[model samples]
Structure formats: structure tokens, C-alpha cells
Target chain A: MLLFLSFLAIIMIASSHNAESKVHEIAKLNNEVRELRTHFVDGKTELMRLKMESSIVKKMMQKGLKRPERPPRKIIVKN
Target chain B: MAVKEKNILNRLYFIAACMFVFAIAVLVKLVNIQFVEGDMYRQKGQERVFKTFDIPANRGNLYDSKGNLLATSVPKYDIRFDALAVNEKDFRAHIKPLCEALSKEFGKSVSYYDKIIRTARSNKNRYLLLRRNLGYSQYMRVKKFPLFEFGANRGGLIVEQRTVREHPIGKIAERTVGYERRDEQGYYTRVGLEGAYGPFLRGKEGKRKKQKIAKNQWKPIGDANEVEPQDGFDVVSTIDVNIQDIAHHELLAQLEKFEAEHGTVVVMETKTGEIKAISNLGRTKTGRYYEKLNYAVGESHEPGSTFKLMTIVAALEDKVIDSSHVVDTEDGKVKFYDRTVRDSKWGGYGKISMAKAFELSSNTAFAKIIDQNYKNNPRKFVDRLINMGLGETLGLAIKGEGKPKIPYPGDDDWYGTTLPWMAHGYGVAITPLQTLAFYNAIANDGEMVKPRFIKEVKTWDKTRERFDKEILNPTICSKETAKIAQEMMKNVVKRGTADNIRTDNFGIAGKTGTCWGNYGKDKEREYISSFAGYFPVDKPIYSCIVVIHRPNKKKGYYGSEVAAPVFKTIATKIYNDIPVIDEVSYAVVESNAVVNSYDKYYQNAQKYKTIMPNVKGMPAMDVVALLENMGLRVKLEGVGKVKNQSIKPGTKVKINQTVRLELS
Candidate 1:
């Protein structure tokens, strides 16, 4: 009878441990998806900024606008 | 001994019975766990492990009829935080650097970020939205931030994909196409073409079943449950982008030059009423062409002389007057009630043909004719106009088409003077498009057609569903009446009020309109000047209208002065750009010289001149008088009526060299 009680206790312990392992695994996957989302957000913002600038530059070119020429600079001492 | 043996046997049976009961109970419990109650635990297991997430599909792209991209959907992302994943003690310690990083990434203040984070954590929102519509790079930088370096799910940060609307054409036709807004009903609807055709423009939303592994953490189920989204169909518009650009540019220039309160330029294909270009420019309070009001469809003022075309058509249809029928224009003015209708000038034009009356825009002659024809029966004329499809909303695919208010004799708004006032364009309101459509019907051989903007709708690949033109009526007038009306309109551009619109390239025929607007705000009677016409009078292809509203005196307020030139400007370019059925040919009508006095002028300057005699310093009245006698056109231009001429005075010039005369 004592042996049977010991075996039943062993089974309960094993099942509870399995449940714990499962919770850990779910946490790990949750972390992965969250990390991926952050990466995606950063990439999107950079793309939008670049695209907006590119469109502006393209419009300027279409209007036949040229870059402004640099003027000669004179050296000055602190006054 | 016998009792002991019996007791042992009963104990054995009892033990067997107990064992059988235990075995049955165990079997029943296994069955319940394995089948009947299995789903409950399975659900519980899923709650512990699986997660669901939304996958936002891309918004559809909007394209022009020529497949030019007008609007499109670009992918964007939302940044979020999962407060439960990080330890509460460490959350505060890490919050400052995270806020600083987010501020730098989003270019917002650090305090704003800090406040959002503190509130989010306090609320215990597992996934709190930090910022939406972040670009890919911004999200990546946020992900790589030192405190957030731990992967998203582990570090309690998230980035979700979404789509943002973009206008590829920018503000071009922005008001017409319209926009989408989420209304109070929690439903999204389109405002313009974007709104009207939104169902066709917005692709169907896809669905997915996902498991929620942790609070606010979801992962998509098997591919079987994930539905692929169908993209929205594209709307192909009737608007030609090139022509639209030209109209926008030209209308802006005219409005600026005229310093007008507002203006609209509409170009429609004569046969189909397929609006090719519609440009509406309104001057801001600062007197600049930057207002967004759609004057073409919204403004419903008395169309004035432009509406005279309808009266004339009605007259021709009733056979009240023939093209050559002559009538004295009441010596310029006639008293009808307290209101006196005049032929523009106070004194009446001399004896003129019906065609000449149309050209000169004799208000007295038209009023007299309308009085004679409709005096006995007003309803027939009103019904005739209604049959021609005026005074009612066109029910165009676009919304907000205003209904015309036609005052009838018995109606509450009608008065005895309504006929005369309505005769010369008053006592009623009609939009620019409605007026154009009426003239368009006349030009289209009396066939009224529904004006359309969206020509075709398609999928991403051009599997087209072409929209056939809606022909509302076969003919509004008899073939004879139509021909007579066409000739009358032709006379308008040839020798009438709009004669200055004549170009060497194409023959134009239409009407000029000038009317007091904004309730005759000034006693001096400033006017809304407009010209509506179609080109190549022989086979009409394109009809256009140019309206300049409330121009200052410096800009020339007459329709013939301000609007006619804009019509010419646009028509000339269209004729040059688009191929027409017939090539322009000016058949030289040579006339026998009444006197050869100009022969010496041509003979002396023949060599120095490029081709023909340059009649510089010649009086325009005399030059036109002589040229019309000799069958030639005198292209006049400038302020004091014929200043310096383009060709040297008295220099022989080629017929092709445009003779520019300054005219005040």
C-alpha cells in the first residue's frame, strides 16, 4: 500500500512539471514574436523617411531645378 | 472452521466486486478525459500556450484611366509595449533610457514618452500602443535600443504591421476623388470617388483564427484557417491626366491674371460627356488661387448669356424664328413690367437677322421671342427645358449634385416677371456642369448623355470592366432644328460676341455669358464672365467652358474679353496636341479688289516683307473693314486699341505670320 501511494505521488509530480515546461515554452515564443514586431516597426519608419525625401528630389529634378552653386567665402577674425 | 471458510469466500467476492467498480470508474474517467471533456482541457491548454495576431492586408491602389497611379497603400507599422513581460522593479529603472530612445526615434519629447509608458504600465495593459504608423527603420532602431535589445516578446515590445494611405498625384484632383473618414457609426466610408467607389476600392478584409499564448500575444493558426485577402478593385477614371494638368495650370494662370474671386475650366468629350479635364480654382482671402472649393459642381448661379443658348434652341425647335429671320432689336431696350430688358447697350441694335441677334447677344430680341412663344403656355417651355435635362440633379456618380430651381408660373416662387428674368438668365440657378451639359447636348446633335468620371474598374491586372456611356435621350430636337442651332452657335464664334476666340487651327462654336453674381452685390453690376463651346464646328469632338468669376476691371470682366481668350488658349493647345478627324483648312476666299490703292503698299514692301502686305499704322476699323471685304482675318491684341503692330508697319508679310494688333 505504501509503495502504491509513492507511485501515485510520483505521477502527479511528473504531470505538474510538464505543465511548467509548457508555460516556459509559450513565454519564449511570445518573446520571439514581440521582438520581430519591434524590428519591423523600425524598418518601416526608416523606409518612409527615405521615400518621402526621394519623392521630393524626384520632383525637383522634374522641374529642372539645379543644386545651388556655392559662393566664395571670406576668412574673418573674431570681432 | 466452516464460518472461517465462509468468511474468506465472501471477502474474496467483496474484493473482486471492489476491484470491478474501481476498474469501471477508471475506464469512465479515461473516456471522459479522452473524448467527452477533452475539448475543455484542450481549450485550456491553448489558452496557456497559443496566441492570436491580426495580419493587416494592403490597401488597394487608385489609378487613372491611363493606368497612372493616383493613390496607393504603403505598409506601415505600430509600436507597442508588453508591460507584463518585464519585471516591475526593473521597468522603472529601464523606462528612462527607453523613453529617451523612443523620443530620439520618433523625434518627440522625452517627457511625452515617459508619461505614456508610466500610464501604460499603471493600467497593466499587456500590449499598449506606443506610436502608430512608424516606418521600418524607426521600428528597427527602437528594437535595437539597448533596453529593448531583448527580442520583442521577451522585452515586452511589439511592432504590428498596418497600411497607410498615400496620394501619388498629391493634391491633383484631390477634392474630386475625395477621402475616407471613420464616422460616428464606427463604420468607414469614402467621401468622394474614394468614398463613392470605396467598396470597389477597398479590398475585402481577410480573417484569421489565432491562439492567444499570453495576454495580448497571439499567433496565427494553421494555414487552413488563414484566409488570403482579396485586393480592392481599381477605378479607371475618364479624366485624362495630361489634359487635367493643362487645365489646372491654365485655370490658375487665368484666375491670377484676372484676379478673379473664383474660376472653373471644364473640358468634356462631345460625344460621351466623358469629362476629360475639370479644374476649379478659388481665390483665398489673400487673393490667391489656393482654395479647395469645387466651383464646377457646387456653384449654382444664374448662367446668364450662356443659358441663352437654351432659349435660342427652344425658339428654333418651336420654329418661331428662322436663322435668317430679321427683327429690329427693340431699338436696344423694351419695358416689361418695372424691369427693363435691354440689348446690352441702352439703345437697341439696328435691324438684325435671327442669327445676327444670337451673335450680338440681343437680350431684347430673345426676351421678345420667348414672350411671343411661351406667353400663352409657360409650362411647355419649362417642360422642354426639363426634357433637355435641366432643373434636376444629374445624379452623377459623384455626390452633392445640386438641383436646379426652375420657377413655374403657378409655383410658390414664380411671379409674372419670372419669364423675362429667366429668359435672359435669372430667377434660377444652374451649376457650371449643368450648363455645360446643356450645351454639350446641343453640340451632340441634341442627344443628352450622362457625364461620367469613372470610365472603367479593374483588378490589379487590367482585366477591365468597361463602363458604357449612358445615353439619356436620342435627340432633344428635330434634325432640322439641331442643324439650325448649330449654325447659330457657329455664327457666335464666327462673327458674334465670341468672335475674338477664332483661331487659325480649329473652328469653334458656342456662346458667351456675363451675369451679375452674389445677389447683384454691387449696384454697378460686376459680372461672372464665361464662355462655353465645342471645337471643330463641322464634327464636334471636345466641348469646354472657361469661367472667370468677379474679375476686377483691370482684368477685363467681359466674357468675350476674359473667358473667350482662355477658351482659345486651351482649344489651340488641344487642337495641336490631339488628333482630330479633319485637318484645319482655311479655304482662301479671294474677292475682287474694290480699289487697287493697297496694291502700291503691297508692291513697295513686298521684298522686305516675309509674304504679305503688313498693314501697320492702319486703323483697325478700316483694316477689318478692308480685310473682311478682301476675305482676311485681323488678329487684334493690347490696351489703347491697336498700338504697335507685330509686323513692321507697311511691311509685306507672309500669310502665316500672325499679325498682332494692339487693341484697347
Candidate 2:
């Protein structure tokens, strides 16, 4: 009986400790998610600013590219 | 021992009595504790362990019409240093390198950082703020630098993260893509699209119960939260980022060139009235320009000659005048009650048709026509404007749409001169967006649609709500009346004040409006130059308005100069945005002669080196190669294939000898 009680106590202690470690893991993962999200949005904002037409025009100016002066045309073919 | 056997039989009574008193006292104290103090102790134990916490849900993103992220919620970091966390030895060993890295990152001098850190250390300051609002990458870089590499406990690095709303396109459309903020009083201050859709953008908060465990960690007591948070639906606005970029820079360039105080431009689809792009810029005290306010939506000012379209439309609809009737301008000016109406041209337009009067935008001609026709029954004219929905607001999705003013006959401010002045667009006020809507109605063939900003609200792939084109007036006027107004505007651009902006690329029909701001005031005069119009006169696509206020007088303040050019620029760029597609069928050339001759040359050049292999009836080009590659000089004298060869097949060739090949 005494040995059985001792085993039960050991199991209780181990289980509580396991739960604690899981909590720590959750905290670490939460931090990681926040950091990763921050990184992703930063990259998205950078890409948007670069993709802007004004930014593109300014960059392409060094290569002598200008916005076209006239409207683009669409041609239809008849079979 | 019961008081030492109760002092024998005689003392036994006294000892029993004393024991009884002590037992009674102990029982009473136990009862008091069980009844009264139990609740207090239970409450104390509860306070030490468990807690209820709120879990915030992620706010939804704001996307442009094409799924480009306009605004989103992201974590920004603030870095602080705990001076007392690191030991003296560690701090001393890495302080110099740490200061150097910080100085390099923040662009401050190393000495400045060193001084501040040493002072903080001496003052025993634990939370010394290094930098605030750093991006994640910058925060990571700072963490990996020198002493900070050891992390929180040993490196004294402390980082605080906060979620903030971010706009990726920066300050270009900051006013339109606005923010929502809350103060301590729980009052929300909302602005722009974010403000307009605050409830939809901000998700619900979840509640959870947690138990305080060891090391300051709170372990969740249950597997599920008491309340589940629902993430906000993503709002997609009807904004084309390409067009928005074009409008913003074009408006900025014109504002800078004119040295204008402020300017605004709105580009709306003609049929649906969906706002494609809106840019509002105001000059700073230091002579720089940024988006200061949503002037296109909130500013209601007198729209000068652009209002002539409405006057003409109203007159035509009432049948008071025909387009062919001629009106005379008295020199350059005419008088109403104490006020004189004038034209921009000194020598009047003399005698011209009613359409020509509108094309010239003559103030005196419009004033005389409206006063002569509508002065007796002014209520009819006012009611006509009201029927056109001119006096009401646009009922925009966003807040603070400016109130349009059209003076009524019974109003306190209405005077005898009100009718004529209103005809010349002086005694009236309307926002740039309202003017664009009216012009857009004409472009849409008398269909007036409400200007819409948001397209839909979505949760992932599922659409929660979708917005459709809302027609305010199906037929604002007869189709012929809209047609006549359209023709008059077309002539305005084709031969009138705005003829300077006419282009052969695409037909732009617009009206120029120039009114002096603060006229007859003690302050210096300022010009409010504006142009309202639509493009591709035959099949209108987008209607736009450009308003520049307080442009320098000497730098050209006329509407044609200051505003029409901006309108033209935006219209041309947006028109070119449509991609040109031309179809061409793919064909494969079947010229085998070129390939065959090259193939033979390649083969013979390899086969014959020291001796000739076979050169019979081969092409002259191949024959020359067959002989020359064998170390013999060859001379060809024909355009066709080789008919005769001087050397026989497989004959051994001598170096530096000449061979003749004849071709047919």
C-alpha cells in the first residue's frame, strides 16, 4: 500500500510539471508568432511602396522610361 | 494529569472546574473562526492564484480593389535596457561595442550613447528606453548586437511589443485610409475608411480564466476560452492603387508649381460612381506638401464657371431657352442689384448663341439669362435644384460629407441679386465630390449614382456583405437635355477657355472654373481655380474634378492653367491604363535549304581533314569547306551547287595547294 501511494504521488508531480512545461512552450510560441507576423507585414509594406506607380516611374527615369503620352488601343480581328 | 489527581479527593473538584473552563474557552474560539473568518481566508487564497484575462483577436486587413493591402495591424517593438540586470563585469566588457552598435543603428554619436547609458547606470535606472516603434527586423538586429546577444537576464535587454495600424502606401492617401483611436474615456475617434468601418475592422475580444503557476506564468485552467473571439471581416475598398498613385503625384506636382495653399482631386467612375482615387494636399509652413485633410469630401466652396453646366441643364429642362437663342453681353459687365457681373474677356462676346455664352463662361451672359428667366418664379428654380438633390449631402460611407448650399427664395440670406449671382456660381457652395457626381451624371446619360468607397466585406474566402451600384436618380433629366449639356461642355474644351488642354489622343470635355477667394476683403486676393469634366466624349469612362485654392496670382491662377492641366494628366494616365491587345497567329518558317546547306557544311568540315571524303554534287559553300578544311585553298565561282571538283573523292590533299570548284 505504501509503495502504491508513493507511485501515485510521483505521477501527480510529473503531470503537473509536464503541464508547466507546456505553458512555457505556449508562451514561447506566442512570442514567435508575434515576431513572425511583424516581419511579414514589414515586408508587405516595403513591397507596396516599391510597387507604387510613382516609385516605379522615379526608378525607371534613370533608364529613360517615361509614362506613355497616349491611350493604348485595342484591335479586334475578324475571322 | 487532571491537575495532579485533583489534589486528592478534596482538591479534585477545584481541578475539574479549572479544566472545564479551559475546554470551554477553546471551543468558543473554534466556533468564531469557523463562522466569521472563514470567508476572509478563502477570499485571500483566491486572490493569490487565479485570474481572468482578455485575449485580443487580430484585426482584419484593409485591401484595395485588387487585393493589395492598404492598411493592416502589425506589432511594433519598443526596446528598453535594464541597467541593473547585467553584472558589473559583463557590462564593462561589452559596453563599448554595444554603444557603437547602438550609435550605428540610430545615427547618434557613440559618445552620446555612452554618456546616456553610464548616467542611467549610475542613476540605477532599470527601464531606459533605447528606441520606440522599431520594426521587427531592426529589433532583431539590436538584440543580436554585442552585449544584447545574451538576452533578457544577462544582457539587460527588454522589449515591449504593441499592435498598431499601418498603411503601406505611406502619406499619399493617408487621409482616405485613416485610423481609429480610443482615449481613456472609451470614446473612439475615427477617421476615413478605417473610422467608417471601425466595428467591422476591430474584432471581438475573447475571455479566458487562468491559474497563476510558478515563475510568474499563468496557466490556462480550461482547454477552451469562456468566450471565443471572432476576427474582423476584411474590408475591400473600391480604390485602384495605380490610379490613386497617378492622381496623388499629378496633384502634388501642380500644387507645387502653382505654389497653391491647398488642392484636391477626385476621380470617380462615370456609370457606377465608384471613387477610383481621391488626393488632397495642403502646403506646410515650410513650403512642403502632404495630405492634410480630405478636402474633396469635406470642403464646400463656390464652384465658379463649372456650375454653368447645371444652369444650362436647368434652363434647357425648363424650356425657358433654346441652345440656338442668342444673348448679348453689355461690353464686359452687367449689373444686378448693387452687384456687377463681368466676363474674363474685356470686349464682350457681343451677340452669341446661348451655347456659345456657356462655352465662353461669360459671367454677365449667365447672370442676365437666369435673372430675366427665373427672377419672377425663383421658387421654381430653387425647387428644380432641390429636385436634382443639390441641397442635400451625398450620404457618404465615410463621415463629414460637406453640406451643399443652394439658396432658397424664402431663406434669410436670399436677396434680389441672389438669382443672378447664383447663376454665375457665386451664391452657392458644393464639395468637389458633389460637383464630380453631377458631371458624372451627365457622362452616365442622366443616371446619378451615389459615390461608393467600400466594395465588400469578406472573411477569408467567404463574402459577408457586398455593395452594388446605388443609383440616386435613374433619370435626372431628359436624355436630350443631358445630351445638349454634354455638347456644350464638349465645345467648351473644343474651342473655349479650356481649349488649351485639348489633346488629339482622347477627347476630354470639361469646364474651367475660376473664382476669386476672399474677394472685397481686407486680405490679399486668392484664386480658387478648378476644372470638372469627364473623358472620351463619345463613351465616357471616368469623371474627375481638380480644385486648387489660393494659388499665387503671378504664377497663373486661371482654372485652365492651374487645374485643367492636372485633370488632363490624370485622365490621360487612367485612359492609358487599359492594356492594348493585338492578336497575331504564330507561324513556323519551313525554309529547309538554309538548314540543309549549313548541316552539310558542318558534317563535311568534320569528315575531311587530311584527305577529301566525297564532294560530288554538293553545294559550292560545302565544297569549299570540304577542300579548305583539308588544308587546301579552294576557289568557288558559282552561286549554285558545285558541278565539278578539281580534287577526286578520298584523294589525299597536300598543304598550301589550290583547288577549283565550279558550281551550277
Number of the top TM-score candidate: 2
lDDT string, candidate 2, B1-664, tens digits = 5656546866777789989999999889887777778788777888788788888888899988988888988888899999999899999999999999999999999999999899999999999999999988998899899999999999999999898888988887899998888899989998899999989899998888888989998878875548877788899998888889999999999999989999999999888888989999999999999999999999999998888888888888899998987888989789887878889999788988899998889888899999999989998887887888788898998888899999999899999999998888988999999999999998888989999999999998789999999999898888999998999899989999899889887899989999877878498888899999999889898999999999989999999999999998898888887756676555566689878877877887876687866676687766766676677888887778777778787788889888887788
User: Poorest 10 consecutive residues of model 2 chain A by lDDT?
Assistant: A70-79
CA lDDT, every model vs. true structure: 0.74, 0.88
Q: In candidate 1 chain B, where is summed lDDT lowest over 10 consecutive residues?
A: B604-613
**Model 1 misplaced regions, further than 4 Å:** A1-79, B1-57, B76-162, B184-189, B223-228, B462-464, B519-526, B579-664
The sequence of per-residue lDDT tens digits that candidate 1 reaches over residues B1-664 is 5679889999999999999999999999999998999999998887676644454444555666666655666556787888778886667678889888888877899999889777877888888888887665566677788557876656887878755666555555666667776778869754556777777787766777776656666655565666767768878788776666667777777888888888889899999889887888887788777537667877787788888888778777777778788777767987787777777766888888878888888888777778777888888888777777776877777666767877777998776677877877877788888888888888888888877888888876785678878887788787787777788888888888988877655689989998866554356657899999898788888999988888987768888988988887777666656543334455565654523535534453343324334555554665554444443456777533346566564555444345566765
Tell me model 2's lDDT, rounded to 2 decimals: 0.88
Residue pairs with backbone atoms closer than 3 Å in model 2 (clashes): none
Candidate 2 off by > 4 Å = A1-22, A72-79, B1-48, B87-93, B122-124, B214-217, B223-225, B521-523, B582-664
